[model samples]
Target: MDVPRGFSAIESSAEIVNMPLSMCCDWQGFTYTMSGWHYLCEMLREYKLKPKNNYRKSILKKYYDKYQPYSTFECFLCEEEYDPLRHSTPWVPLPWESAFRIRLSDNQHFGPNSNTFIRKEFVRTISLYHRLESQGYQPQENKDGYIRGHFLKKGDDYRFKVSGGQHRMAALGVLGQKDLHVKIQPDWKRVIDIQHIHHWEHVKNGTYSEEAARKIFNFYFETTGIEKAKKYGLL
Candidate 1:
């Protein structure tokens, strides 16, 4: 029995080895690679899965260019690729750029400016200008030109004493100009009488209720007017 069993009597065995390796991470959700860290994106060559379409591919390319590993915790506003970041502002109308003649007269006038409708009008004008330009019309003049004035800080918390561009300035703020740098046009001083007209009517004629004026003033002093109507509370 021993002689016959020789090789047949012995047997070999293999054991499965389990290492402490981490899960795999994906590159732009294309190809996935093994790594200890999450939110991983690999080199472009290593990109595995093709985008669903050309749009997706384009988006991926844009994301690849500006994306940094540490930016995961940052706000989208901090990204240069953000939509708002596309336009540099206090956007001046260029010579070649076609736009409508936006004049201060075409807009409503107010002192220390009205919080209402100013933003709406500014946005409307800009939007129209963009549309017209797209259609190949050039604006010969900007009637609704703005004037610039720096804040002459009065005291603690520094109240701004209406230096210039009261209406257009309010409009710009409402329109959200973080990079606005255009100087305020100098002619705003000539329009002071017209400016006071709106205020006189509203304040004296009571076009705006006393309660409304108080609320509007309080809202402006408090928030950036982004959430004014919603955040406003009556005393």
Candidate 2:
């Protein structure tokens, strides 16, 4: 599979170590880990916030409307008549839809799909939480035997960006596991420079200058990253 210019598949032997859960991040390099599911679990536990299916649809429609503009392709959600599942061409999200999904994930609103998938994930997250709580997180049980990712170091602070086993990582996080056994790839530092991560965060927070953020974003994701960032006003 082709990756971005600045990214590569994990090819080197990974070093396994126990690292703090708070230091781990999702694939987008964000510190927020399964926050949406966490929120759902909390609501269920504390407030019994279960609404009817129609009510759920009403809530999800708001999110769909908000993120639909960011979609570039004629997916089933956007096009009233087009159905990619039946078409000869396999549909994939373009940069715009990808950007839309990122924002949706950040807000704990999984979409570009119906509420069914989101609800399924919520159920799965709950299942995972119970399994981890009972099973005690055995690394050997996982196919990879560990949560796989790479460590990004900015000065003394480190963040592990998960490349695999995100669901399990999120489960551990939700369970309040302070640390995890992780497999850190050796080539991450060479592919994703720490400075790039720093600049990206600065861009997200509107702390970095546009010119500088563009340069770093371009390096990380080529022109497409810059375009998405600008479209979302992150740069």
Candidate 3:
């Protein structure tokens, strides 16, 4: 687990209450244990961390998988598409009402990376937004004060890739309702980073084939210099 770059522990707690401590701990542990900084350097050496690579990784495969068949749908939006055979009433750790992340690019060319599990979880989030809106959740006026300006990570530019709560945002956009408040409690980035790293590691290690790994690795690492070969010591 890597201590997410931008925010400090104190700032994290004060700014976002729901920030996942487990994620923070995991990131800190991984970087400390694994000597992960060298991976960043290697990526720079290979030129695999370019923005073009990241764009390809994040966008292309997502479009492909969206067209592929999925097995289940645990949330509202996906409830219509996929089925929950067993655990008919199983619940996820995160609740429906919690303030979560949502990326601006969704299902489009530069949608969230498929390697990130948060993308799948977010399918249900759209329905949550619909539910809230249907129940007469009013829009806010001073939207700038809302959670729109939150950073993805300390060092990373651009907003954090939203793991959930996208539908609410879209509804607000469609309604031209800037008054809605988007709250961000940042904890998942550590976990997300872990997942991102693990997925590529699996790919590079031959657990997942080269084809599947290529798009995924290139997408996230392109801009960040997060290469599988360097990060996992394959090089």
Best by TM-score: 2
lDDT of 2 by residue, 7-110 (tens): 12233333666666665655433232333222233322322244333324443333333334332222212233223453333232321112223343423433
Better of 2 and 3 by TM-score: 2
lDDT per residue as tens, model 3, 1-235: 2333333432443332222211211110111012222221222222223433442243234332432312212211123322245323223122111232323333331223354443343334334445655764433443432332232222332223333333443333333342333334444322233234334444445333444333332333333212322332343
lDDT of 1 by residue, 4-33 (tens): 111111121111111111110011111112
Decreasing lDDT order of the candidates: 2, 3, 1
Whole-model Cα lDDT per candidate? 0.25, 0.45, 0.31
The reply for model 2, stretches above 4 Å from the true place, is 1-14, 29-110, 185-191, 195-235
**Model 2 TM-score on a 0 to 1 scale:** 0.50
Task: List the candidate 1 regions with Cα displacement exceeding 4 Å.
Answer: 1-146, 149-177, 182-221, 231-235
Query: Which candidate wins on lDDT?
Result: 2
Candidate 3 residue-wise lDDT at 86: 32
Report the poorest 10 consecutive residues by lDDT, candidate 3: 24-33
Off by over 4 Å in 3: 1-156, 177-187, 190-206, 209-214, 217-235
Backbone clash pairs for candidate 2 read none
State each model's C-alpha RMSD to the native. Answer: 30.0, 11.7, 16.5
